[model samples]
Target: MSRIQQRVAEAKAAGKKLLVAYIVNGDPQPEVTLPTMHEMVAKGVDVIELGVPFSDPMAEGPVIQKGHERALVHHTSLKGTLELVKQFRQTNDKTPIVLMGYANPVERFGYQAFATAAADVGVDGLLTVDLPPEEVVILKDALDAVGLDNIFLLAPTTTVARAQKIAEHASGFLYYVSLKGVTGAGHLDVEDVKSKLAAFGQLTDLPVCVGFGIKDPTTAKAVAQLADGVVVGSVLVEKMGSLEGQPAAAIATAVGEIIGGMRAAIDSL
Candidate 1:
């Protein structure tokens, strides 16, 4: 199993729901990224979805869009993000790091070269927001060769047939975009999500993780009960955005507290 798959399996065996935290790498500043990563893991994040900033992040809401903008000011490229992951791996190796972003950067870096560098730097998975399974052959094949997980997203509007096709290509875990709108938009309908998850469970045994619209411990706990994992993103990114001029340790602590609360709530299950 890849690091991501192993981490998810361990959480399942222990009767615990995974808490995956998402943050834009080099947000506010490049120097703060590594410390914040370590702090999040210490606060109980099972998996780290480190977003590589792209000029046009179509799936992200205003909050995360601004995060990408801030990171871009510091010139956070895909190469720079990988360097952050390498630095993160120096002191910590167990927590799975999944690079989440657009396809352009990976393509610019070259598929095979990007995958090899990512795996060498301890990256566990890739979730290219715009890369659908149909067009994922070159990238997915590269990741497969490097033993890295190729993660995919399934939206609320996805047809049963489409989801089945996506499940066929997805590994590590499938990220279920909880909101019909962009990330950080809309409120979650717990019953609707529950029903959808039940239907998805019939299609594949792979762990299904819910993201987008999970903003607090209450929502985190609620989603934890239905899915194998709960992914909290926007709220944390919003926090990071608000603390732009603050010290790195303070920023890390602030975000860590959010994860800590959600962790407590998930563990309470």
Candidate 2:
């Protein structure tokens, strides 16, 4: 089984839900990336979605967009993101790392070469934001060849037919965008999310992870009750951004404490 599937299965077996955390790599600064990563995992993050900084991140909100801008200022390329994963692996190997970004960098890096290098650097999955299901066969084949899962997003407006197509193509876990708008936007109705998750349960056995507007422990707990996993991106990134220019230990404490509360809430479910 893929590492993602294994981790989800382990969470299921333990009667606990998975807590997936998202962070823009090289955000705030390049040197802060690895420390934040290790700290998130140490606190409660089961899966790490390390976002590759991109110029045109359509799906991202203002917080992540600013983060991307900061990362780009450091010239954080796709290759540099892979190297960060390699450096992260030097100390930690159990936590699954998923490169989350747009397709331009991966395309520039070449499908086959990106797959091989990602696998070599201990990356467990890829979540290309703008890549559609119909266009993922080549990338999927490349990823499958190297044992990396290709994760996909399903929005609130996705039709049943499209959802099925996504379920068919997606591995790791399917990310369900809870709100219709972009990331970090407010207004996440838990009842609507619950209904959508119920509908998705009928279509695929793959674990469903809900993201977008999941900004706090209460919201995380509510989402966890309905889905197999909860993903909090914008808020955490915002917190990290707030802690910029501080000591690494301070950032770790602030971020860890915030996510630790989230972990506790999810576990409380």
lDDT of each: 0.93, 0.91
Total clashes for model 2: 0
Off by over 4 Å in 2: none
Give the TM-score (vs. native) of candidate 2.
Answer: 0.98
TM-score of each: 0.99, 0.98
Alpha-carbon deviation at 37 in model 1, angstroms: 0.5
User: What does the lDDT come to for candidate 1?
Assistant: 0.93
- Give per-residue CA lDDT, model 2, range 43-162, as digits (tens): 989999999999999989899998899889999999999999999999987889999999989999999999999999999999998889878888999998998998999998998888
Which clashing pairs does model 2 show? none
RMSD of each: 0.7, 0.9
- lDDT, model 2: 0.91
Clashing residue pairs in all predictions, respectively, total 0, 0
Regions more than 4 Å wrong, model 1: none
